[model samples]
Target: MKEKDGISECPEQQVILYVEKEDGKYEAMQTGSYISANYLDDYFLKRGTLEKALGEKIARGEINAIEYYMILEDLTISELAARAGIMKWTVRRHLKPGNFSNISESALKKYSIVFNITVKEIVTRQSGNRN
Candidate 1:
């Protein structure tokens, strides 16, 4: 089946599945192309007890994608700074939207420590306009 955006979902028996996003929303093209509730239950059971997780982090009265990336991975500015070998302010500047640029190694390291995630997961080249 095709979704409004013409995206199709190809369901598989794998426990972990990938969902496509269109215009910032999830779209399913056809039934059975997506996993059913029962499938999720069985997948979660096979893995372990699931914990509540947020899609992103809220900060400064705004939902910044960088903030969400850091929070979801459990990273902090100070820690990331140390890892990048740069000042915290530098890290902040890079994290801000529209400031698409490379981050220092020290910052990447700190992010890894705080979020318990990998450097590859934290850093992303901005897409489209900087802001």
Candidate 2:
């Protein structure tokens, strides 16, 4: 992006951007994130809707904490399995409400680590504790 075209809609949230400067040189510039500035509200709106739907599913016992955290983290089964060092099939099993009970404590710890959450949070599904 050109230096003059750099979006500064959010002064509090500055990001380093490589912008085209005058005299035809590229230079590092401080600017607000284009997507964040332009689309943050829409992102939040969609996120709220998803959260509400997921919360309803959780309340209905159609899914478990494992699945809740997984969806909220935007992780695929294979990606979560890789991060937690668990088998993909096992991760899939844990995503089910009934099958989550069969998971071992060590496995739960692995998932908690992957989610950056406490094991208790994984057990309870009380989310929004990202560090």
Candidate 3:
């Protein structure tokens, strides 16, 4: 892959991983979450770590630079809604900022199970700036 800056440009065949951000940093994330890359700072707690890692990788040319692509592989709202057995509107509501707070633990658990990803990955804490 062609490296640029410090972000990986995922290949067409590769799935774009989603990470959560909290408190102005990047956090790990589980699948099926609605967090968007555009709001990475808001949902991710480990931005420093991610940036550092990507920077090193970019310097070595191990991966391409990061850029947003129109295509993504993560589940859509409708797909998540189907798995949750809820209406699409419910999924949309859960993805909303204020509405996300209302999602029940049980619902989150079910979503995690269906997506086969860990809650920790979904909600990662920010790592310290030790690099």
* CA lDDT, every model vs. true structure: 0.48, 0.81, 0.44
lDDT, residue 102, candidate 2:
85
| Candidate 3 lDDT (Cα, 0 to 1) | 0.44
Find the 10 residues in a row with the least total lDDT in model 2: 122-131
Q: 85-114 in candidate 2: lDDT tens per residue?
A: 998988888887777668899999999999
- Give the Å shift of residue 129 in candidate 2: 16
Clashes of 2: 0
Local accuracy of candidate 1 as per-residue lDDT tens digits, 79-130: 6666556678877887665453365566556656665666655453122111
Candidate 2 RMSD to the correct structure: 4.1
Q: What TM-score quantifies how close candidate 2 is to the native fold? A: 0.81
Checking candidate 2 for backbone clashes, the offending pairs are none
* TM-score, cand. 1 vs. native: 0.34
Give the poorly placed runs of model 1, Cα more than 4 Å off. Answer: 1-65, 73-86, 124-131
- C-alpha RMSD values across all candidates: 15.8, 4.1, 20.0
Error of 1 at 127 (Å): 7.1
Predicted structure with the largest lDDT when compared to the true one? 2
When sorted by lDDT, best at the front, the candidate numbers are 2, 1, 3
Ranking by TM-score: 2, 3, 1
lDDT of 1 at 76: 86
